[model samples]
Target: MKKILLTVFAITFFINAKAQSAEVAITKKENDTGKIYTSVEKAPQFPGGIQSFYHYLAATIVYPVDARTKNRQGRVIITMTIEKDGSLTDIKVVRGVSPSIDQEAVRAMSACPKWIPATQNGLPVRVLYTVPIAFTLGK
Candidate 1:
């Protein structure tokens, strides 16, 4: 059928397109740690350290001044994965208040410094961690 053939063609095209980009490969590697290109000798610390990182980041983020980012605009809830290498990646708005606030959440995330990488079974391995940051304006 035409539909099946088109689907296969689309899949193949996407595959080839991904193979052609260095950024795509890097992003994919960042998502998946199974395929080893080089040894990630530097491992991040555990949840305790990540908690500390969050605490510090919370104090450091500059709340956006836009209408939606304001307290009057409601709350911004963001969920993102903190990778094993202590890198913050895949920031997405799980519960969004507004587009402006969503972008602010992402900006706040990017502003954060590197964290202690995560570990698995005593070895440094990439682990998926979830965090929710709520933006609330003052009283």
Candidate 2:
């Protein structure tokens, strides 16, 4: 049927678009640095450390009203690259529960303070970090 064909086309288009975007990001990072690393010898960290990072998230995020009304609760896994300058870039939701929730996660990440840049061989390096933002309704 026409509807089925359209659906298939849409899915294919979306997949291709995502792949292209990812490729572009990878290419840009490689050009900026020699390589992108998932983990470095000294991984990036919030100024105050892990505990403070969690506290910052808890303080910063404002739950989306639509998601709260729908009772949608889950973790949104976000992937971002920490640049050698300690700033975050290329933030994207790797696993998203809902649009509103996902947007909120990205917003929080964008507002994050600079981290202590990751290091390899005692030199700063760009690192890819994945974090999960949990959305739970307060009963």
RMSD of each: 15.4, 12.6
Q: What is candidate 2's lDDT per residue for 1-139, written digit by digit as tens?
A: 3333233223332211121222233423466565677655666888897666766777777888999799998778888988889999999999999999999999999999999987777888777788777777655
lDDT of 1: 0.48
Lowest summed lDDT window (length 10), candidate 1: 13-22
Q: Give stretches of model 2 more than 4 Å off.
A: 1-29
Which candidate number would show the highest TM-score if scored against the true structure? Answer: 2
Residue 7, candidate 1: Cα error in Å is 52
lDDT of each: 0.48, 0.72
